[model samples]
Target chain A: MTDARDGAGTAAPPSAREAYRDLLPALMRADDRLYCLDSDTGLFDRAAFAGVPDRYLNLGIAEHNLMGTAAGLAASGKIPFVTTMATFATTRALEAVKIDIAYPALPVRIVATHGGLAAGHLGPTHHALEDLAIMRMLPGFTVVVPGDARQAGEAVRQSVGLPGPVYIRLGRSATPDLDARAAGTGPSAGEPFEIGRAQWLRPPGDVALIAGGPHPVLAALRAADLLAAHGVRAAVLNLHTLRPLDADAVVAAAAGTAGVVTVEEHWRSGGLGGAVAETLAERAPARVARIGMPAAFAERVGGQDDLLGWYGITSGAIVAAALNLISGTPGGGTDDPDLSRV
Target chain B: MAGRAPGAPGDPPAADLPAVAHRVREHIVGMCAGPEGGHLGGSMSLVEILTVLYFAVMRIDPRRPAAPDRDILVLSKGHGAICLYAVLAERGFFPVAELAGYARPGGRLMGHPVRAVPGVEMPTGSLGHGLALTNGFALARRDRRCFTVLGDGELQEGSVWEAAMASAALGLGNLTAVVDRNALQITGPTEDAIGLEPLADRWRAFGWTVREVDGHDLGALHRALTQAETDGAPEAGRAGRERPVVVIARTVKGRGLPSVEGKVRGHYARLSERQAERSLAVLRARRRRAAP
Candidate 1:
C-alpha cells in the first residue's frame, strides 16, 4: 500500500507528470525538435519514453547534470524539458539553473515535480517550499505554479511556445480538479490562459484571495465559497505565474476589495505571498494578509493535509484571514503569527 | 568527409600549430599582466590545446561561429579565459584589435568567457559544468561534434563525474573532453589540496574511453584531438555506440616564459609595463629561434 502522501500509487487528480505523459505524444508529433532530460526518477512510463529514444535522455540521479545537459542541448538548437524533484533542482542544482539555463536565457522548460510539500510525509527533505522564490529571483526566468493538472498541462504547453527558460512547478499528488471551476463565470474563462496572466475563479467582491500552486488555489476557491455562505463577498484569483506576475490583476483586485489575502504552500517571506505583497505595496496599497508557512524549518512529519494544516495553509485559515481583514482587525488568522500588514 | 587523413589534399597543415600557439600565448601573457591579472599558469598551459582545436582539428567558419554544425569547445576551467579569447581572436571569430578591450570597463571580455564573445559556445567559469554541457550538445545532434577542456583540479568537483557517467550511459560518441591536468590549483598543488591521482581510473570507472596525452605537446594534442573527431562514432551514426572519449592532457602550469614556468608564482600576475616587456621579449626570442 502506497501512502497518497508519499507519492506512490496515489489517486489524486491527474498531476503535471501524467499531463505531460498525455501531451508528449501529440507534442512530439507536432514538433520533432523537443527533447526530454529525465533525471531517472521514473517520471514517465518506460514504454512511451522508449518509443522516442533520440528525443529523450535520462540524466541519472544527478540534478545539476540535468541542467548542464539542458544548457548544451538548448545551445545546440534542441528545446529540452529538464525534469527533477523541485527540492533537488531548486536547492541542489540552483547554480546550474542560474548559470547554465537562466544566464543564457535558454529555451529550457524546467518542469519541476514534487513541488511545495507535495512529497508530504517524506518530510522536509522532500519538500520544495522555496522553489518558486529561488526560480523567481533568476532574471529572464518565467516562474509558474499551476493550480490543477489542466492548468499545469496548459502551462507546460504555453512554456514550449514562450521563449527563454521557464520553471513549471508541479505537485507530486493528485490534486482536486479546479480548471472547470476556474473557467466558469467569475473572471470569464473566455480570456485565453496565457503565461504571466492570472485566472479568476470568482467575481469581484469586498475581499479577494490571491493564490498560486494547486493546493493553495483550491483552498482559495473553497475559502471563497465559505466566505459566500457567511454573506461575505470574496474573489478568487488563480495566480499560476509568479514572475512577470499578473500585476494588472493584482492591482484590480486590490482596487475592488477592502483588503487582500495571499496564500501559498511556501514561506511567507519570499514565495507567492511576498510577490503579492510586493505588487500590492507598490501598485495598490491595501491591508494585505499573507497566509503561508512561518519562517521555520519542519520538525513535524505527516500527510500533506496535516502538514498544510500544521503550517496554517488551509481553507479555514484563508477564510479567517479574509474575515479579519473585512472586520478591520487583521491578525494571525491561523494558529501561527498574524502576518497581515496594513 | 570530416575525417580527413592527416596528409589529405584538403586537410590543414599541423606545422603552423606551434606558431599559432606561440602568438596566442603572447596575447594571453600580455592580457594577464595588464589591468586584468588572470589565471596565468592555467592560461599559458592551455594555449597549445586550444590552438590545435581551433586551427588544426575543429571545423569552424570564423564568420559563422554559430553555424548549426560547427564543432564546439567549452573551456571548463574558466579562470583561464584570456587563453580562449586570444585563440578565438586568432581564429578570426572576432577582431584581433578587440583584444585591447578585454576586461576593460564595458568590454565583452568579462573576467570569464561569456556568450557575448562571438566564438564562445557557452559561458563557463564554474568548474565541473563543461563536460555535462558537451554531453548536451552531443545528445542534441549526434552529427554535431563537441569538445570541452577540464582542469585536473576541477576533477574534484562531483558534477564532472556525474556528467562523465551520463555521457557514457547515453552513448554520446560525438562528445570529447580534454582534462588540462596541470598539477596545481588556485590554492596549491592538487595533490596537496585534494588528490585526484587515480583520475584516469575514476573516469574509466565512470565508463569513458580515457586517453592520456601531453597537453603541451602540439603534435600529440593535434593527433589526439583530430583522431577523436574523425574516429568518433562511425557506428554511432549507424549502429549506436556508447563510448564517449576523454583525453587526459598532462601539462605544466605555465609551460612558456622561463621565469614563471612550472612555478606557482606563474599562476597569476598583474605585470608592470616593464615585466610585460620582458615577457614579450621571451616570446619574441622563441619565435626568432623557430623562424624559417
Candidate 2:
C-alpha cells in the first residue's frame, strides 16, 4: 500500500483511509462496550458510525465538547475513542485533555490524524509540529505514533483494550512494511506490548539513537546505516509511547554508550527529547544531544521528504549530531536548553 | 411528590406548595451550612420551581431515576446544586440526611451534581455543557418525554446557542428548556453581567415553541408544563421530526426569603447565622399566612 511519490501533490493516503474504514465496523459493533466522541460529523462518514448511534456522539467541531463528552461517556462506563486532527486535538482541545481525560483518568483513546506536517496546503493552521511536546507533557497519557499503516492498525487495536488515556498519532501516508527481522524479537514484538515501554530496533553499543512518530522509524533506519559507515556502532530505539516513556531503557543505553541522540518532528523544546531528559534527570541523568525542529512554526509547505529535510530532521542531520555528541564536541545544532529541570 | 401539576392552587388548596418549598429550603440551607460554602441565593431562587416540578409536573419514580419513561430534568446552572439535592432527597431519591454531608470533606454529595446522585441527570459545573447533554436526552426520548432546566445566566454560553439550534432542528418536543430568569450570576445581575433580556425572542427565533411564565406562580408553571407535554404530539407522530420547547420562567434571584429576594448583591453572597435564622422566620410567617 506504499505510494512512493517523487515530491508531488497532496491526497489522502489510500492505506490510511482504508485502515480507518476497516476499523469502523469493529468500533460500531463494540456497542455499549465501546464509545466514540468526535468533532465535526465524524460519525456521518461511515455506515457503522452514523446519526446519534447509541454509543457514539458527534460533538460538531467543538473539540472541547468532544473531550468532555468522551470523559463523560467514560465516566458512565464506556471505552471512548475521540477522533480529531492532531493540530486541533493537541493545541486547541489541550485543556480538556488535561483536566477531563488525564486528571480524571478517563480511558479515552485520542486517534489524531494529519500529524506533523501531513496537513500540507492548510499551512500553519493545520500543521501539528508541537503536538508531541504537548501530549508527552501530561502525566498518565501514553503517546503512540505508529510508523505506517500496519503499525497504525496495530496501535489502534492495542489502544482499544488498554486502560487509562492513550494518545495515538497516525500518519497520512503508508511506509514500507515492518521489517520481518524486528518482529517476534523484543518485548514489544511479543503478546501486546506494554503501554509505557519502548522497542529496541537495533542493539546499543558506542552511540545510542532514539526517534519517535511515524517519520522517525524511517529516519532511524537511514541514520543507523550512516552511523555504521562512519565506524560507529549505533543502537536505534523507537520511542513510541512518549509520556510514560521507557526511561529505564534510555538511561541504561545512555549510561553504557558514549552519549544519547534524540530525534522527533516536534519542536526541540518540550517534545520527545524533553520527556526523555526529564525522566533520565530524575532517575539517571546523562549527557544527551537533542535533534528536532527548532522552536518556530513551519511556514513552508510541500511533500513529506521536503518538509523533513527543510526542518533539518533528515537522517544525515541525525548522523552528524550523533557523531558530535559521541566525540564530546557540541554541534552548532545543539541549542535546545538542557531539560534536566523539566 | 409525583402526580400533581405545580399549580392546582385551589384543587390542592395552595397550602401544599409552601410545605414542600419549606422542606426543600431547609435541605438547601442545611447542606450549605454543613460545607460552609454553596450558592445559597441561587438555590433559594429555584425552590418554588423545583417543588412544582417534583410535586406536580414531572412524572419521576423515586425508585428509578434512569427508568426509560421517567421525566428527565437537567440543572444546567450547576452552582444552584443544593436546590436539586434538596428536592431529590425529599422525593426519596436518597436519604434526606445525605444533605447534611453536602460540600463537606469525605461526603458523597459533591458541590456539583454527579450521576451517582439520584435524579441528577448530567455532571455539569460548566455552563454550556448541560444544554447539549439535555439535547441528547431530549432527542433520545423523541418518542415522548424529557425536560431540562437551564439558568438564564448560563444561556449566554455560545454552546448553549449551538444546542438550541440543533434541538430546534431535531424538533425535540419531548424536551422543554425552563430558563430560571432570576437575572443573577456570580458577579452581579445577569443583565449587567451579560444581557439576556431578549432571551425569549431568541429562543422563538430559533424555531421553538416559546412560553413565558412567572416561575414563582405555581398555576402558570403547571399550565406551561402541561402545554409542553401536549406540544410533542404532532412532532412525535411525524417520526422523522420534533420541535424544541422553551419555557421562559421569570423568577427572583432570591424568591421566598425577603432578606435576599431581588437583591443583585445576593447572587452568591453568604448569609450569617443570624441572617439564616431571620430568613427561616420569614418563610414560616409566609407559610402561616398562606396556610388557612
Candidate 3:
C-alpha cells in the first residue's frame, strides 16, 4: 500500500506511509469503524478496508456513531478503533469517548488521525490540540502517541492484546524517517509493540528529554544536537504511551539526570508533560520543563510546519527551551509545566 | 411461562400480579431506607416494569447471566438501579440482603449499576448511553433478544436520539426500549425541563413499533412486551426483520407509597424513618389483603 513517490517533491514523506501501511492489515482486519453505515473519509488512505478479510466497517464521517458502535463491538469481544479526524473524535464524539469507552473502561482504541495541525488548510476546526487534555481527564483511558512509524505500528499491534481503553493519536502530515537499523523491523516488523515502556534513544546523559507522539521526536533530535554543542549531553526518551505512563522509567531518568524536558504537540494540560510531572512529583521530583501546545485555539490556518511554529511547538523552539533550562537561564516566568497560553 | 403469545393485549391473573408488585415495592423501600439516599422515585416507577420483565417475559437464566442466548437488559438511566438490583436479587442473581449496601462506600451496589454486578450488562449512570449499548448487543447477536429501560428525563440527551435513529436504521427487532415516563426529573416534571409530548411519535418516526403502557400495571407491561414480539408478524419468523420497539410506560414517580407516589419532588427526597415505616405498613397491608 506504499504510495510510490515520484520526482515531484509534493508527495507525502515515505516514512509516514511506511508507518500507516504496517497497521493497514491489522486495522483492516479488525477496525469496525470501517464498516459503519457511512463511508470512511479517505483521510487515512492506505488499504480500502472494506472487502478486507474481516468485518472492517468504515463509518464514513460520523465520529460519534463510530465511537458508540465501537463500544458495542468491544462489548461483544471485537477490538474496534473508532477512527476519524482528531478534531471530530475529540469534539463531536467526545461524549461517546467519555461515557461509552473510557468511563465504562471499554477496550475501544480511538485511532484518531490528522492530529494537531496535520490536517493542513482544513483550518483550526479540524486541528486537534486539546484532545490529550480532554482524554486524560478520563479515569481509565490510556493516551498513546507514537513517535514514528515503528512506534505507531507497534502501538496498534500491541494495543489489541492489552487491556482497557486507549486513545491513539496519529498524523496526516509527513512523519520523520524511522531509524531503520535501530527500529529493527525488516520482515519481522509485524510483531506487537510494548504498550507502556519508554524507548531509550540515547545512553544516559545529564539532561533527560522525554517526548511523545510525533512533534516530540523532532524536538528530541534538535535538543540532543543543541545539548551536545554545550557539552550538556542529553538523553532522548520516546514516551509512546501517555496513561499508565512509564512512571518508573521516567522517575529513573529524572532522578539520574540534572533536569527533564517533556515535549509534545498537545496542550500542556493533561498531555505528556502533565503525565510526566505527575510521575516525577510522586516518584522523583526534579526540574522539569515542558514544550507543547497552548490552551487557546489557533485562529490562524496553515500547513503542519507553519502551525507548529505558531504554537511554539517546533523542534527549534523545543531545543531553545531545553538549552535555557539546562543552562539555568531560569525561563523568565514560572517553570510550571503547563505554561502554554493557547 | 415457556411460550406464551407475547403482546396479546389483555389482563393477566391478578392473583400473581399483586404478589410480584408487593415484592418489588418491598425491595425498593427496604433498599432506599437502608442506603438513606437513592433515585427512590425513579426506581419506584420502574418496579412494576422490572417485575414484569424478570418474572414473566424476559427469557433469562439467573444462574447464567452471560448465556449465549440469554435475553439482555440495559438500564440506560442507571440511577434507577434499585429496582434492577432488587429484581435481580429476587430472581436470585445474588443475595437479596446485599441491597443494604446501596450507595455505601466500597459497596457493589453503588448509586449506579456496574457490569461488575453479576447480572448488570453494562456499567451505567450517565444518561442516554444505554440504548446504544442495547443496539450493539442486539445487533451483535441478531439471534438473541435485548431490552433497555430509559428515564423520560434521560431522553433529553441527544445521544439517546442518536441511538434511537441508529437502532431503527439497523432494523434491530430484538432490541426494545422501555421509557419510564414518570413526568418528573431531578429539577421538576420532565415536560417543564424539556417537552417529550411528541416522544412516542419521535420513536415511531425513527422506525420503531411504539407501544404505550401503564407502567404500574403488571398486566399491561406483560401484554406490551409480548406485543413487541409480534410487532411485524408477517416477518416474525424471518431472521432480521424484527424492528426495534419502544414501550412508552406511563408511571407514577413513586408508585407504592401514597405520600410520595406521583410527587414531583420525590426523585431524590430522603425518606424519613417514619415515612419508611408508613410505606412498609402499606406494603404489609397490601400483602395481607392479597394473601388469598
Candidate 4:
C-alpha cells in the first residue's frame, strides 16, 4: 500500500482538532454571540481565551450538562460551540443534544473530536464509530464530517449563520490535505466551500469513490491515483456533510460512473456508505461497495493508522473495492464476512 | 374579592397572588379535562410557584416576550408544563381561551413546553436539562436574574447535579432554582423511587444557598424568590454573597384535587367533566373557608 505522505511535503498537516482550536479566537472576535464550552477535552489552550476569559468555559467532564448548557446559551441568543470526545458527545450526551439542541433547533455547534478510530489505542470505549450515524439520524441537525483540517475550520465558520443544531466530527491526529492537492485538478476545484455541498476531488470516470472524514477521504484520493495506474479511472467525492446531504452530487456521481464505492472510518451499516446507498437506491441505482469497519469492535489495541489498516480502511482496500465493484463481483474489498481477526 | 382592585400589570401586589394561583389551578384542571390528559399532579403542585414568579417576582412583559434584558424562567420539570402555560396566560402572555387547545391535535401546547408558546424561554420536557439552561442564561447576561423549577423526582437525573456544580463554580449570582418537592412521581413517592431527603444538604454541598419553603404559600414563595434575587445580585457578589440559591418548596402532588392529593395516580389524569366540576368546587370551598 502507498503511504499517504509518499510525495507530500515534509510539514505535517494540522489535525481537525488543532484547526478548530486555532480558529476559535478568530470566531469569537467575529461574533460576540460566540462562546466555547469544553467537557475537559484538553483540545484547547486556555491561553487563547485569556482576553475573553468569561466566554471560554471548561465545564469539567460532564458532556450531558455541557450540551444542555450550550443549548441554554443558544436559547439566550448566544452561539455556543461545545467540545467533547465524539463517543461521549454522541452516546453519553445524546438525549441532551436531541432535546435541548435539536428539538428546539438551537444554534449549538457540537464540535466532537476523536471521531472513529482516532482514539483507537484507548480501546473501543473511546472510538466514536457511531457518531456520524447517531447525529445524521437526528432531525434539524446539520452533520458534517470534515475531510481535513481546513474543511473542519470551514465547517465551523459556516455553521454560525445556519439556524439549528450542528454536529461537526473531527479526527484526533493530523491527516493529509486532500483539498490543497486537488485545488486545480477537478471541475469543482477552487470553488468556495459550502456546508451541504460535496467536493469532487477527482473527475468522474469508470468508478466513483466517495468518502468523508480525514483518513477515508485521503485514502479515496490515493485510491484514485492507484486505479489510474491500473488503467481504471476512479472519481473521488468528498461528501463531508452527511445530513442535508447533497443528494444531487451522489446521484450525479453514480450516474456518471459504472459503480460507487463509499469509504469511511465507521460502521458500514450507517455512516457515509449507508447514506450514499440510500441515495443511489432511490435516485440513481448503481453497484455500490462500502469500505469500512465490519460488524465488530476492535479486538486488538493499536494506533489510529494501525486500526484502520487492520480493518482494511486503506487506499489499497479502496482500489480493490473499486475494481470489484466495476467487475460486478458479489463481495468486494474489506466487506469481509470473516471476523476472526476483527 | 370585590373590595380589592386589580394590581398593576407586571407587579401585582402580593395580596393578589392567591387569587391568581386559584385561577391558574382552574385552568390546569380544565386543560386536564380535555381529551388528552395533562400532568395533573405535578402541574397542580407548581401552580403557586409559577404564579408568584410570573405575576410578582420576575420582571417580564407579555407584549415584549423577547426583551433581551427581561428575566427568564425555565420549567425544567417539563411535565408541569400545563401549570406554566396557565401562569403565562394569566400574566397576559397569551389568551386564557387558548388553554382549551392544550394537548389537543394541531395545538401548540404539547405534553411538554416548547418555544412556540410565548413567554416560554426554552422548550423542555426531558428532566435534568433546565438548570443547565438556566445557568446558560445567567452566564450570558449577568444583569438579568434567571430562574427554573425542578421536580424533586427530577433531582434523580445526574445532569441536574452536574449543572449545580457548574452554577456554583461560575458564581452565578443571578440564578435561582425552585424545587417542587411534591414527594411523589409517576411511580410512587420520590423517596421510594430515589430518596432526596437531605435535598437541602445536597444543594449546600454543591455550594449553593438553600431555602426550604411551603410551595403553596404564595407569600413565602415570593419572599424566598425576592431574597434569592437579592442574594444573586451583582452587588451582592461584591458583598460576598455570590452563590446561586435553591428554594426547596415542600408541596403535595395533587394540591387542588382532593381525590388524588398525594397519590401516585394524581401524576397524570384526564378528568371527566364531573371530576373537573368537583375539583373546582373543592378549590372554591377551600378559598371560602380561608376568606376573611
Name the best candidate (by lDDT): 4
Candidate 4 — which pairs collide?
A: B173-B232
lDDT of 1 by residue, B1-292 (tens): 0011123222344457777787787787778766777778989888888988888878887767788988888999888799998888777777666776778888899988999899998889988889888888888778767899998889899999888888877878778899888888877899999899798887777766778899988889877876643244244322445577788888988877888887788888887778877888888787789774
Name the lDDT value of residue A198 in candidate 1. Answer: 87
When summed lDDT is taken over every stretch of 10 residues in candidate 1 chain B, the lowest stretch is B1-10
What lDDT tens digits, residue by residue, belong to model 4 across residues B105-178?
99898889979999998888889999998988899899999999999999999999999998988888899999
Query: What ranking of all candidate models by TM-score puts the best one first?
Result: 4, 1, 3, 2
Candidate 3's residue-wise lDDT over A93-139, tens digit each?
88877877876787877777888767767877788878887877788
Candidate 4 positional error at A338, Å: 2.7
What's the residue-level lDDT of B177 in candidate 3?
Answer: 92
List TM-scores for all candidates, in order. 0.92, 0.81, 0.86, 0.94
Please state the interface RMSD for every predicted structure, separated by commas.
0.6, 4.4, 2.1, 0.9
For candidate 4, the TM-score is 0.94
Better of 1 and 2 by DockQ: 1
Error of 4 at B147 (Å): 0.6
Local distance difference test, each candidate: 0.80, 0.70, 0.71, 0.85
Clashes of 3: 17
Question: For residues A1-342, what per-residue lDDT tens digits would candidate 2 score against the true structure?
Answer: 021221222323545435754675576585445766657734235456554266555667777656655664564456777788898899887866776577657687898888877766667787788898888778888898765566667777777777788998876665554444356533445334445677777776688788876566567666777788989988777777786777888886677777778888777888888877787778876767787767666565656666666666767777877888778886554544333311
Model 4 lDDT on a 0 to 1 scale: 0.85
